[model samples]
Target: MNENENISVLFKIVVVLIIVGAIFGTFMSIVNFALIRSISNEISTLNNLTISSMNDRMNRMDSDISSLESNIQPGGIVDEYINAYNFLSNTNLDLEKLLTFASETPDATYLTVYIAGRSNVWITVTNNGQSLLQADLKPGLSDYVFFISGNPNVKTSYTIMLAPSSIITTSDASATYILLAQNGKTSILHTKSPSLSVSNILK
Candidate 1:
């Protein structure tokens, strides 16, 4: 072929390459724009979710604070202590012994124990193997009271056993054990043992 023909062919080739490159560039730009928009939307959605989570946590915190405020009682602990003190003061007994006996009862805050011998009986009250009251109680109303820690967490248990007079002693003696809780709840137990003298007399 002649030089002019070759030159025309070369010009056509260059023009076609330019058109292809322009089309490719446009497609790439469109793809890049779409990717950027998708990335921006995802970021925006993540940000909104984070904000919503933060707001929910803040609301929960506010609710907790409100609950705490509502439950706060003024001088509640002081009132418990005062009640215990008044109960103890009324007994007019050895405060130390009464307090010790109260300390021995288990799962209790405060207690008022009343034990009546109903006869000339030996009264032995022990707490954790330690003697609290070991005396002879006569018939009629027995004046036994106690005051423990007003705090419910403080706890102990006691054992009260009774024996008859020297003339009528027995291995197992009749006993009356009473447990009074701080809330004025009473639980009385009349033990039936080798002798029913105490229960019969008290009844």
Candidate 2:
């Protein structure tokens, strides 16, 4: 081949290689972007589904607790517990309600509300064959002590006493609050409250 033809051929080949490289680069960038977008979308959808499912489960559980609370004997600190539960289940952050419910600026009180676990014992009362439902610590006639302690489930068994200004709190939220309490025996110890309440409670 002539020198001119050879030079022209080399130039054309170089140009073609540059164009091919650009096309390949553009294709790889588009593929990478699509993969990233797909992964991000999948993650977002999964997160949304999980959150929505959790909220639904919480709502159902709140309904069950409300049903059980409705069976309470009208006037008890149980109403206060229901209030605390309402504060817990709501999504629209009621700062005022939560602060008020958890407020302990004045002092602590007696009567603690705990999560509904084995603490409840369903009972059936019959008066002249008329059935009345009552719940307690046991299926038998045992007092359901609603006392406040650092821990809701204090291993020590104590009967409910009408104590004035006994420390109280509630498990209104998931987070546990640390508490320091003294039982007047020159012993200093700390406990935690689920939520805050007044200091006076009648057993």
Candidate 3:
């Protein structure tokens, strides 16, 4: 062939080789990028699954711990404490019922009086103008016993007088009276009784 034609053919071959190299490099880059993205997605999915499994395990562990705590035996401290409290409460109720029964019986020889006050006071109990008991009472609650002279089954009248210890005059003192029977019936004598004068009748 001629020298110029040979040079032209060599130039065309070089150009074609360059174009093929460029296309191959671009395709390889695209393939590498797709592989990297797919690998990253798989890694993220694996991490999510691991986290979910760990959370499920933790939840199960918590539930097991709660169940163990709830399975306390009857001889445990918590159970014993509850049992003792119930026993004490029941015993107190039984004692109260017994006292009430005794107080309502016809053979009972004494009457009980409960006093509640806001301040210190002097109390006097009288039956038919005869003084039965005289004492000093402090604030809060107090119980007193007075013997009955007559037949307990019959109706009886009694008087209670309360005077503040800080006061000297009897005019400011308050008085309450009642008629009670052994059958556990009572009637208040005064209309303007003190608010703290609460009584329970036994049956």
Candidate 4:
């Protein structure tokens, strides 16, 4: 009878040890799951913050590009710069033309005349018996003619002649005035015939 009682006690102790091991395994599993979940949450939050920072940087870059485009639009700094460059180029061209004309006559006693016409015409300037100048004058085009008499004290006479260009037909000959300037005096001479004369213009 005693032997049977001891066998029963040993069986009961084994059952209790098995139950405790199962409970400890369950508790360890819960702890491990909680740790894993907390780590995953932290990583997700970091990714979101990184994405937000990148979006802010991209937004700032886009704003800067838009502002730059507006600044380069019409009537802006870029437009004004182009206008100034063109103006300076034209001014330089005009100055070069004036310098070329001034080099032709250096003496103070020489008579200088500028001839301009509204229509295409052929021009000639003569003093005494010598030919002084000849050129073709067109609309917006002019020529500087210079002549010097042997004696500056004596007044000089110049015979000016104007004729239609070869491109002009008789029917196409319209009324136009040729401008002549000398010694601060400007004469608007009418083109009526092929020949004209001016005697009173003096240096």
Best by TM-score: 1
For model 4, the run of ten residues with the poorest summed lDDT: 164-173
Candidate 1 lDDT by residue in tens digits, 1-203 = 99999999999999999999999999999999999999999999999999999999999999988776655543344443543454344335545554455454455433333333334555554444455565564432234443343443333343323322111122324333333444434344333343333223222
Rank order (by lDDT, best first): 1, 4, 3, 2
Residue-level lDDT of model 4, residues 163-199, one tens digit each, is 2111111111222233444343344443344444444
The residue-by-residue lDDT of candidate 3 on 12-57, one tens digit each, is 9999999999999999999999999999999999999999999999
Q: Give residue 92's error in model 2 in angstroms.
A: 54
How close to the true structure is residue 198 of candidate 4, measured as C-alpha lDDT? 45
Q: Positional deviation of 55 in candidate 2, in angstroms?
A: 0.9
Q: Give the number of colliding residue pairs in candidate 3.
A: 0
The candidate 1 region of ten consecutive residues with least summed lDDT is 163-172
- RMSD for all candidates, in order, please: 17.0, 19.5, 14.2, 15.9
Candidate 1's displacement at residue 192, Å, is: 45
Error of 3 at 154 (Å): 38
Counted clashes in each candidate structure: 4, 7, 0, 0
Of 1 and 3, the candidate ranking higher by TM-score: 1
Ranking by TM-score: 1, 4, 3, 2
Where does model 2 exceed 4 Å of error? 71-203
